[model samples]
Target: MQRRFLVGLIGANIGKSLSPALHEDAFAAAGAQGYYHLMDLQVLQGRATLESLLVAVRTAGFAGVNVTHPVKEAVLPLLDEVSPEAREIGAVNTVVIGRDGRTAGHNTDRTGFRRAFEEVLGGKAAARQQVLLLGAGGAGRAVACALMDLGVQVLHVFDTDAARAQTFAADLQGRFGADRIRAAADLAGAAWQAAGIVNATPIGMLGYPGMAIAPELIDTRHWVADVVYTPLETQLIATARRKGCRVMTGGGMCVHQAAEAFRLFTGLEPDVARMHRLFNEACARRDAKLAAAG
Candidate 1:
């Protein structure tokens, strides 16, 4: 009998995620049989309930699981061990369960972020230019560290939570140095001073509206990137494109991360081009659904 594989995403507000479709398509393209499920854990509030659900998933023979949002940090404690990257980022997005009941946590966000940055900007985004990062949460932290590894001269970080932003800034600075980091409460005052801008927040996601930063602040001289890929062409990316700024969409990061996860489970390098095509088709389907609803 052939072995069956199962994968799932655990977190709230994942109904809008394209992960299921992407993974399913990759499975088909690879001639593999498996089901990728979206598990909304918001219903299982508190640590006990979440742990119970996780324990159940492991027992049910799931190959692995993907963590997102509110659970990235929460899932850390539940795992038996974590990768150095995940530990350093203080977040985990993928969890693989061992047959002996051991769980290992890993973060693929940095790998995805770096690939997307290099693919979109070629070699122009060197380590000597300032980066105006507009979020300081899990996603933001991963991308910031990825940027530092790529030679970012400075990272000007910000978030609505001033304290959180300051803390992340200080942490990165301690590791990367004071000469390469600065935390800000907001970007309203310093938009024009950076080489590029990145949005790691949920603003401009499918159900969300508006760009995290004002459109007027974007100009032809800057490079812009957003981690929101649901609406591949987010309001921020659209506005930046209109202003002649080079823009990077989050879809690349999404596909790359999912690809790495696929490799983790299947030990095969899936066709990225095929994955990209399937993903674009899925996005189009989603857009049609949204249009019909409106």
Candidate 2:
């Protein structure tokens, strides 16, 4: 008999998320009965709350859930337990609910970012000594640690919310040491100083459509990476590539991270390559539909 698994993602402005297609494809290939649900906050309104959704998923026999955006950090205090790594990163992107209804939080973003960074841009890009990280939100928190582990001697984190950027940078500074990380209050100045850049913000994604760093700020010498894969290539990535900078799209990170999340949810190893192919195919199809509609 095929094993059954139920999993989902929780986030706002996520109707365009490729996660359902990616995971369902993986499950089918693995010969397992699976349902990948989307608990989008945009569509939910008052129909449900984050706290209520967790309880519902646990009671409804869900294997786990992936949290994103505004909720990743918010979900931390709510989980029954959190991995030390997730705790240290100060965010939780993945949560596994036990059969006994106890929920445990984990973070695959760190390893996922590192693996994807190495895969797409190579280790040479990560050791740039200094990198500008846009957004100090949930994803940024994970990517920040990844950059540090990958040998980034200095990381300048920036967020539209100055306080968030400062607080997050301070937290990371304590762990990685004050000399390595700090909030980049001057976006323009930091862009000039950093050798490479990583965009962990949602700004360049489908719904949020704009470059986090202005086009003028991107230089030919800098390398760039983004965490938004829905459009496949974000504006920042496209701009950087045009400027002759080495670039990486969020697709690789999304695939590698989802591969880890799939394993945690189903105890099955997902074919990362297969997921990558599916992701591209799905994005192409989605773009085609949008183009046709217009």
Candidate 1 lDDT by residue in tens digits, 188-267 = 65577788999998898876778888888887998999988878889999999999989999988998889988887666
Model 2 regions more than 4 Å off: none
TM-score of model number 1: 0.93
Q: Deviation in angstroms for 156 in model 1?
A: 0.5
TM-score (all chains, Cα) for each model: 0.93, 0.97
The true-versus-predicted C-alpha distance at residue 31 of model 1, in Å, is 3.3
lDDT of 2 by residue, 67-150 (tens): 998799999999999999999999999999999999999999998999999998888777847899999898999999999889
Indicate the residue-level lDDT of 248 in model 2: 90
Off by over 4 Å in 1: 42-49
Name the top TM-score candidate: 2
Model 2, C-alpha of 292: deviation from truth (Å): 3.9
